[model samples]
Target: MITRYDSNNRYSKAVVAGGFVFLAGLTAEDCSLGIEEQTASVLKQIDDYLERAGSSKEKMVSVNIWLTSMSYAGGMNKVWESWVAPGIVPARATVESKLATPDTLIEIMVQAII
Candidate 1:
């Protein structure tokens, strides 16, 4: 069975199905922040969502990150490395893409075991 949380008109913020929890792409609330701060904010949000889904970062199986510019990758990585569960790093990919908003520098989506 599938269970969803934080639903809105557009989509659910997270969904649990097939023993996994999938989170929608999340961005920092304050888009004015720099890459590092935005990355940190997004990670924190991920942690909260994972916990609410009965999982944690250590249970993550995959992650997809998008940056508005590749130049911000280094800063994004620094925060990612620090936030990821040590020794249980999940499969991850980072790519440059145009985000939904001009001020948004980064977005992250994740899948974790429930």
Candidate 2:
């Protein structure tokens, strides 16, 4: 069975299937936020959804991150490196893209098993 949450007109923010959770792409709410703040906000959102699905970041198997500018990769990596689960880090990829919102600097999606 599959469960979806935060449904609306546009998209479901998260979904759970079998023993895994898939989080939708998420970006910072405020455009002026820096990479660190944006990363923190995204992670927090992920945590909330994971908790609801009976999982956590440590259980993540994969993660995909998108950035509006590649130039911020270094700074973003710094925060990501610190937030990731120690010793059981998930496979991750970071890419540059023009986000859906003009002010968005970064967006993240995650897949995890409970």
Candidate 3:
């Protein structure tokens, strides 16, 4: 059976099914932060949800990151490289896209197994 968590008016923050947890695109609570800060914040949020779902970054299988501008890639990656599990990092793709708001720098979605 499938389990959903953190449901809001727009979406469910996570859905657990078939031994996997899928996280919705997470953005920083403080949109005023820079790319590095935003990425870090987003990762931490993901971590919290993962823990709640009995999983962690080390168990992640895939990730999709959207950046408002390619110029922020370097900044975002710096924080990501440090936060990711040491070995066998999840497959990830980073793309430049127009976010919902001008101040929003990034959004990240994660998938992991229990």
Candidate 4:
């Protein structure tokens, strides 16, 4: 069985199948914010989506994080460190890359179990 959430013509914000939920890359709605603010906002969005998908941060299996530049990683990590509990942290990879927009500082993708 499969399920989709927050779908639009372009793509679903998340898809659930085979007992796992796969989320699309998400960026803060207000990209003009700094890295810490953007990361915090995106983390909140992740929490909301996880709940809607019948999971939580503790269920997250993997996370892929992208930052517009390596310089912003510290600020982003600060926010990430606070939101994620120590033991429940998911397998994650953070990389420097160009984002969808110049203003967008970071983007995150996640996978979680049902």
RMSD per model, one decimal: 0.7, 1.1, 0.8, 0.7
Q: If ranked by lDDT, best first, what sequence of candidates would result? A: 3, 1, 4, 2
Single out the weakest 10-residue window by summed lDDT for candidate 1.
77-86
- lDDT at 88 for candidate 1? 97
Cand. 1 TM to true fold: 0.97
Tens-place lDDT per residue, model 2, 1-114, is 999999899888999988889999988767688888888888888889999989999899999999999998998889887887789899999999999877788999999998
Which lDDT tens digits does candidate 1 get at residues 60-83?
A: 999999999999999998988888
What is the clash count of model 2? 0
How many residue pairs clash (N, CA or C atoms closer than 3 angstroms) in each of the candidate models, in the order given?
A: 0, 0, 0, 0
TM-score for candidate 2: 0.94
Q: What are the per-residue Cα lDDT tens digits for candidate 3 across 12-106?
A: 99999999999999999999989999999999999999999999999999999999999999999999999997886999999999999999999
Considering summed lDDT, which 10 consecutive residues are worst modelled in model 3?
81-90
The alpha-carbon deviation from the true structure for residue 81 of candidate 1, after best TM-score superposition, in angstroms, is 0.9
Off by over 4 Å in 3: none
> CA lDDT of each candidate?
0.94, 0.89, 0.95, 0.93
The per-residue C-alpha lDDT of model 3 at residue 47 equals 95
Off by over 4 Å in 4: none
lDDT for 61 in candidate 4 is 89
Question: What range of 10 consecutive residues in model 4 has the weakest lDDT sum?
Answer: 81-90
Candidate with best lDDT: 3
